[model samples]
Target: MIVHLIDGTYEIFRQYYAPRPGHLDGDGREIGATRGVVQSVFTMLQDGATHLGVATDHVIESFRNNLWPTYKSSAGMDPLLLGQFGWLEDALRALGVAVWPMVDVEADDGLASAAAVAAADPRVEQVVICTPDKDLGQCVGGKVVQLDRRQDKLIDVDGVIEKFGVPAGSIPDWLALVGDTADGFPGLPGFGAKTAATLLARYGHLEDIPADAADWDVTVRGAAKLAATLVAQRENADLFKVIATVRTDAEVGTVDDWHWSGPTAAFPAWCERFGWPRLAQDAAALAAARS
Candidate 1:
């Protein structure tokens, strides 16, 4: 009854830099990361993960780029690493795992959307969003949680509060004030984590905070300056919040559609083409045993 939503983009990046041998196909395409991800997913299946889905960044640039000129893009990324994204999607699909290749929206949005869909299903016991991205923290609550696979960490609602100093609902507001360098947005001036968390803890949201620091109940150092910065950049703060919020309207399918039936017939050919013939054998053996 538990549903696992993976961040394929993160996985590929992680594996690419990990201590491992490089792999190239007949045409000299780099595929070690892709192979590593396939192995990792198979390991997940072997370890009792049932319902699973993976979301990948089909294109690194999203609508957020149009909104902010400095939003993260794939400009400096290694061509070899970037080249494997589509192959990774194809490999996951061949493994019979549902893949959401996000283009207009990023992989994080797809995970958020899938997590929302899975959490709303009555038959689901839990929804695990498998990523360590701070943006995904907004989706953690109740039956839905975020998992850091690399660290074996599980973050629930309480975990979100413990880590971010605010509740899940306040994450966007918190990010807006504190800024997220990963997403390429500089938060309001004079508002660091402690200041943002403290103010947000008291006021709950950006719009709810009093215009004058003297009216605030909490005492923050440089409160007057922070208040002035917030007041001056109110419009920019709102825009930043919009950028921070993960869109749950992405077209991730329902829970039942995410179930892992087994690998497709194309899997063996894909493995051979990718120069991992052992993967073909392993996948077939696993599928046979499971069947």
Candidate 2:
């Protein structure tokens, strides 16, 4: 069996910027992103998806914010888009998709957790992490791939190596050195793409790197400054690693618990609230088919 793990936060962002207008359900509840999310999930289900799970950031402020003051916070986000987070999770559950709404942990962490759990199961043949987030790359292992549902891109372990120029294990260190804008932390100055990879490939981690540029063995541009910056901001590199590493300890439930069983009676109420008549019928049909 294949497990398809989706990044619900990314989906919300995608639907918010879509050209389509807002959708109003029977009770006049506005559901723009929620409708888009249901459509995307349905499209995937039509494309032979069996075991599917979606992870959403129930609260945007995760543990990463505590580590770095400049890390991503929802304070600047649009209220309309932020309001849809909960509705999206409810809509997915109504459509029979397993939903993981993370509070302290973010959606990426939940996807990483799901990938780890699925990869360990012998019954799960492939675990498709359905997001383009770079952090999820660390969870890509044998038979586990990252799927960007928007672009229909499937990223495997080789794809991780090809994209980052390092193995999956080195992604955290690479991200630490390179920095991530989405997470809101700027990597060390002069530590661009090539320099970080060569150093990480040589030393395995930032901690093992030589403190002085003169002690370096590998050749790269601006080596002296990059090495100097790394030593000067060793504390920042360690902090970035802490932010980059996705936690797998989230309560995503087991594979059997995540098995799709369609929706219960609450599904129709959700559709009615959102004024999505067609969705109610389609969801009911899918639920009956699975039963």
Winning model by lDDT: 1
What TM-score quantifies how close candidate 2 is to the native fold? 0.94
* Candidate 1: residue 45 lDDT (0-100): 88
Runs off by more than 4 Å, candidate 2: 26-29
List residue ranges in candidate 1 displaced over 4 A.
none
Each prediction's total of clashing residue pairs, residues at least 3 apart in sequence or on different chains, is 0, 3
Q: Scored by Cα lDDT, where does model 1 land?
A: 0.91
C-alpha lDDT of all candidate models, in order: 0.91, 0.85
lDDT of 1 by residue, 1-291 (tens): 999999999999999999978888877878989988988988998887889999999999999999888999999999999999999999999988999999999999999999989988999999999999999999999899999999999999999999989999999999999999988999998889988999898889999999999999999999899889989999999999999999999998888898787889899888887777788777777767877
lDDT of 2 by residue, 41-136 (tens): 877776667788999999999988999999998998988889889899888887778999999999998988888899899999999888898898
RMSD of 2: 1.7
After TM-score superposition, the amount by which residue 194's alpha carbon in candidate 2 deviates from its true location, in angstroms, is 2.2
Clashing pairs in 1: none
